[model samples]
Target: MNEVEGRGLCLHNNSNGNLITPSSDDDLRNVFHQIRTTKNPAVINYGASWCRVCSQILPSFCQLSNKFPQLSFIYADIDEWPESTQHIRYTPTFHFYRDGERVDEMLGAGEERLRDCLWLHS
Candidate 1:
């Protein structure tokens, strides 16, 4: 998988949170592994490039990364991970992970709602 900052899903301690984009299934697994090992809270946005709602919330998602440096923000295109993301039933689905376990999930989009979710998770 092609990563902007390579290993650890770019979720390592940093001044600003990173929005990781995994290129392959292996990359996604590696990312999760890092999250699990580090026990860092993470948010994965499962969306499709062609989905209008996905496009709308993505920019806000990126901006939130800057606001919540403590959280790992990841963007996963459902199409790119067809096999790995088969359970995803909605565009712009968000999965929240903490202590290597998935704790919550949200589907659909709204900037304010997303910001609130991030705040709660962060």
Candidate 2:
């Protein structure tokens, strides 16, 4: 089972869905910078809270963080960070970054598919 710990914006991975939420555009930029400079594998989930699909898959996205402890998990709500997320055209879009570059993207909500993708990258 997945247990989320803490709330609000977090820069480092912890118990809260193992997710790092950016509080501002600068923080969001920091996330990207850290991922690139550190060469850490990261999964960024771009979604809006109002979207049903996004809401449904969000918990799973957080839960999966526990399963893939090797990868960094980030949750970016488009509405909350519009300027940085304007490129997101779909709800619940998952972007995978590996070796400092965005390597793949998964659009939509599919638990199995997401799990498989995380496994591949993990």
Candidate 3:
């Protein structure tokens, strides 16, 4: 577990998922920058540990990351990074970005919806 800026959050590097947790405002900005600059599609899962739905769908989310190697997958905790989730209204919101722009957004923990968005965007 790699700590970022003493935020208590760890950036998981395990092979189970390539998900990244932005621990600070700058880190979050860098992630957005990468999403904008990268040619590949990017998806960010906005969630928190306390959210039951988030926890339930996390495994599926990680699986999706492994399933889609071409897309960049990220996990952002709304409680830890409020600024990054100002516009987020739901716990497990998935934002899809392509060509530096947000092409789609899915709210809730529905696996099928998430997969559909990924399939369409990624």
lDDT (10s digit) by residue, model 3, range 8-96: 44444446455667767678889998888875688999877778898778777777877777788888888777877788888888889
lDDT per residue for candidate 1 within 6-108, as digits (tens), equals 3222232334636678879889888889888998999999887678888778777877888888899888887888877899999989999889888889899
* Runs of candidate 1 exceeding 4 Å displacement: 1-17
lDDT of 2: 0.81
Clashes of each: 0, 0, 0
| Candidate order by decreasing TM-score | 2, 1, 3
Residues 2-106 of candidate 2: C-alpha lDDT, one tens digit per residue: 222233322333464456777777888899999999988999998776788877787787778878888999888888888889999998899999999999999
Number of the predicted model whose lDDT against the real structure is largest: 2
List the lowest-lDDT window of 10 residues for candidate 3: 4-13
Candidate with best TM-score: 2
lDDT of 2 at 68: 87
The TM-score values for the models, in the order shown, are 0.85, 0.86, 0.83
Off by over 4 Å in 2: 1-17
- Model 3, total clashes: 0
Clashing pairs in 1: none
